[model samples]
Target chain A: MPETKSQSFDESQSAPMHKALQREIQLARNIQMKLLNGEKPELPTGEVSGISIPARLIGGDYFDFYPLGDGRIRILIGDVMGKGIPAAMLMILTRGAFRSAAGAAQGPGQTLTMMNDAIYKDLRKLGSFVTIFCADWEPATGTFVYANAGHSMPIVVRSDVGTVTLPVLKGVMIGGLPGQIYKEKTSHIQRDDLVFLYTDGIVEAQNAQGEMFKLDRLSGILVEQSRQTAEAIQNAVVEKVNEFTKGLPQKDDITMVILKADGDQRGV
Target chain B: MFKYELIDEEATTVISFEGDLDIDATELMEEEIAPKLYDCSNIKIDFSKVQFVDSSGIGLLITLIHHLRERGIRVRIFHVSDEVRIVFEMLQLPDIMGADVLPEFEHS
Candidate 1:
């Protein structure tokens, strides 16, 4: 009788342990999904389409859109240093920080500064860093002010003209240093202009030949897809990237944000 | 990517990081240390060991700076390497993050 009781107790314990592990995995998946499908903020002027595709169930890439008051819109894109759950969690933190700071009436430069200060200590504790791009657009005046924090250069496409790569302002990766000041630059948005922001995952995407997708290819695609709507352009870019990889395993998360400045649709 | 080391001083905190300062590092920082930002006013970070960084890292830093500034805290940076220093110069981070390369340690 005593032997039977011991066996039963062991079985019960094992069952609960299994259930706990399953629950933890589920929770991790849920968090990753949330990061992938982040909350979308309404646009003050033109339509915006943002997409993030993680190489793994949990990825290190992130993009975010948030509306600022006074006809201003904030857009951000970032890449974490590593992969897996830790990277996903970092993406979440970055998204939250961008939203909170930009939402609190901070401009691109100030926002980057504040973010750097917020994470410097924690980053030291964990020995990690992040690259980011933050920009504020005023639809009313077609003015764009941005601060680059060690991210890729955003491409601007004009309906009449071809695509133009905006120059990156002087900035360092956040959390790597505190008190590193970031500069901001302003540009007048032309009519029917489209801004494209993306992560290295897109350019670094490899093919069977072990060749990277490269920026030239991305630029060509952007030029070809310039006529499409923001959402369509985003979809097309993702599709092209997938086709390029040809069902191969993705090594990193691919994320992109497309912003179109349409004069006629400014009210939207 | 983004990492840092914190040294508690009399009235200031010295933090340093190596490798890439990207999104993953940002999340680790937020989860592990964001709460402590409320306590310090003077903060310094060293980025001599960083190799590459991106926009997400910038966003995280800006947010942190804003948080500390709101509480009347002052932040500084030291020992930024040349390669990474170019990135900071291009983004004009010095204007925003109060960062400057350490002049004392010449890059080898």
Candidate 2:
């Protein structure tokens, strides 16, 4: 009798709590979207665009552009461990660390080192980690310097070469270990070459048949759309993923950042 | 969407994981598998049946190994499929979790 009474009482108490929770989650989604969709920096020699689609109402994927003056923009893309509200909170933490680190760090590698130093203890305490790729793109000089911390390598699509194979550069995921020094690599972005940075969700997105979209399919689309604008290419990839999944709900967050070198080189 | 089997061989316990090791497996790993393995002296993880692992899955795997290793337990992972192995290699799990933990497969 007591158990039945408790069940009835709990049913009465749960509805309002559930409604309030849903409302709060929606509000949180709004805040996250606003932060993620902040103004794109105006680049003179190339155009850059980014987008994120959470597996849930909110997600852990993050991308940001920080203009460092003189036509150079610091671009960062990261995938926090896990999904949903917990991951979203950590993503905000990651964004804060990057903003603070980018202000003083000279290059991508240094920024990563500072970020790791800032967040390693907290991440270890929480039993989590983040995979990130940071890069400084100077549009005026077409210099693309980047560093990776256990994130997927960006796919480069050159008009003449198709998919360009990059040298293997990897580091332990942020928070995996303390005192990590991420090494930097440099590549010149020739005119019309496209650099695609992404989270694993895109390649791992599964269809109803359980077939993944994989890197090969993504690379083919990038190569075919190499001539498109950054925004267009981003849209094309998203469209293809949607088509591939056929409305099956994704289990992980999908995110991508695109950088396309323009034909004319000038500082804005 | 993950399941596991435990086989006791002398003093060593071998655990084989099957299905996608993603967010949904968190509860099972934390509440069931981890608790069962904490007291073991030696453990071997079989990743041959594991087809996919996401960021969240990676976190779970690392946490499980770290906890076991902290207790001075010997852990080794073998029979990882090429796909799953690539993900582990990308994260450089060999370096962080001890190279001996995830050793190269020996062809017999």
Candidate 3:
């Protein structure tokens, strides 16, 4: 096979095109990181923090905090199906829906309902779905109200009780069906209690041996780190996950949010 | 990595999969697996050897099932292990993909 003029010409143009694409992907990853690590609401009585680590250059996992007018902070965490650039695009869409719905909705359940209505058609058309866990935390009153959209349940940790089991609540994932009304569940948050919300990526992370960092291991770590600050606990979990995975490349985005009641009240 | 064996018969098509289903299966699912099922009237997916399925896998699985159903193919899944079944239950796959498609099977 001999190289023709067309082949020579095509080879001449491929390098810069590849370089330009790489630059664009790097910029996209920076934008995603900034949005995901955006401002956290200043709570009067507790602390909240979140982090996201994409498995690829850019990822689909998302988490945000919106301060409500009534002193409660609206928290959203979700994992969009698939990964990389396509998932990252849908994550931005999900963030927009959550932000718009957070201000207008009265509770976590309503927020999810509105979000579903906003993005359901688009998701269906794309053949993708997102599992989300949304919650409204009132620092002064210690009221924790949350709703689920086919996402993992948040683990509640109390120093005296260990990992508190939450009652099961079910709802279809966004785009799973139309006209979905996600039901809400309420729980009391005492002072010093920590709520651990995460995507499946955390537990599903695998090591070189093909072993997963299961829920039991995560819960044990949480129980041991219950005495630390919200940020410390978050870091501890990440460190343990890194140790468990032993530097293996992850296949999914790892993300989590920590909300802890700090015991000083300014509003109810 | 994912691998599958397709067994097509006169009235039914059975596909057995082995290995963890994840993002790696995207191309194979769309280009290879789905095209094979287009002409089948009935399809059954065997999950006996599958041990893990992540979110990406779920997405591919959803697309496959919906694609088949939209074409009037009757699809059902059986032999899912308890661990993978728990993941499916958490995501409410039974409801989203039709409960009949994901029937109960005894865990060995």
Candidate 4:
């Protein structure tokens, strides 16, 4: 009779393996949550409110607002190419790169170009890309300068004209190619104007029948809820998406950043 | 919903993905596929069978792509459905991912 090889087993191994995995997963969740809640850099001239909802425990979406020395606010919203640990990791990289590049006094376009170059140079090392939107707001002058790197175009809600979707700032996704040039554009925000920055999660949310929440719905919501505070606007947007999904599991992270020019005529 | 299969064609590793690429599948992919990324030079992702992909899925792909690109490795995708293709095009990722649209196979 051929001797059968005994299978090795520790009765205690199963439980600890499961427990260790659970602990690791929990730790990851906590880290991601902390990154999401990281301090909102102080705005010297205006107020800023931002919210991010990961479709799950981890996500690829991110937003940030920081005050510049020249009395302008720097706002950034971006989506990494993938989700989960990979996306989360890339989000961290993009955030770091953007912050460093912006701190060097680079304008939106130049900052984006440098960021794109940095990401692209590391792309072969990281094997991913990101789409980003960076903007500078001069509270005193009510002038807004923005650059887009294949990210979603922000919606501007004017006091008199209602909701308006700005054109794409014209650029490809960061880390996709080398020497890509990002275009910067400028616009003036009148008193009481509202600027809404968001991730695709909001508009792409689906209903029971698989219908999209749609941009029109989002625009309508913005128009109706324009008077709400930044926090309220974030909450309202989440609520609308939740209602539309009707209890479906959120498929992606949802992030929104709202800035309202308080109609102050004082220029910085 | 997610399913994965490893196919060997002419020494190339083709991991075929099907169904929804969301949070659940994203985790599964990281667990099952991430380790293998370092082992192959020519990695082909078959998304023709994929139904839907959200930001999480895109994030996972980006991470994997970034890692592979760093190693001087390239990832190729094939069989993308119309919907997944649109998402890629919207994000302008085809050129970066080196994904090529293959001719649809017709059965006579």
Question: Local error of candidate 3 at B33, Å?
Answer: 0.8
- The A-chain TM-scores of all the candidates are 0.87, 0.95, 0.96, 0.89
By TM-score, how accurate is candidate 1? 0.67
DockQ-derived CAPRI band for the predicted complex in model 1? incorrect
- Candidate with more favorable, higher TM-score: 1 or 2: 2
lDDT of 3 by residue, A34-142 (tens): 9999877787778998999998889999999999977899998999999999999999999999989998999999999999999999999999999999989998888
True contacts kept of 2: 0.91
| Candidate 2, A1-268: lDDT as tens digits | 9999999999998999999999999999999999999998887668899999999999999999999986799999999999999999999999999999999999999999999999999999999999999999987787889999999989999887899966768888899989999999998888778899999999999999989999999999998888888888899999999999998999999999999888333311
DockQ of each: 0.14, 0.87, 0.80, 0.31
Higher-TM-score candidate of 2 and 4 = 2
What's the residue-level lDDT of B59 in candidate 2?
97
The best candidate by lDDT is 2
lDDT of 3 at A79: 96
DockQ ranking from best candidate downward? 2, 3, 4, 1
Off by over 4 Å in 4: A1-11, A263-268, B1-90, B93-108
* lDDT at residue A87 of model 2 (Cα atoms): 97
Q: Which is the better candidate, 1 or 4, if ranked by DockQ?
A: 4
Per-residue lDDT of model 2, residues B17-91, tens digit only: 999999999999999999999989999999989988899999999999999999999999989988888888889
Q: Give lDDT tens digits, candidate 1, residues A175-233.
A: 76678677899987775888899988888787988677978898888888787778878
Model 3 ranges off by over 4 Å? A1-3, A263-268, B105-108
TM-score against native, each model: 0.67, 0.95, 0.95, 0.73
> Candidate 1 local accuracy as lDDT?
0.73
Instruction: Tell me how far the alpha carbon of residue B14 in candidate 1 is from the true structure, in angstroms, after superposition.
Output: 31
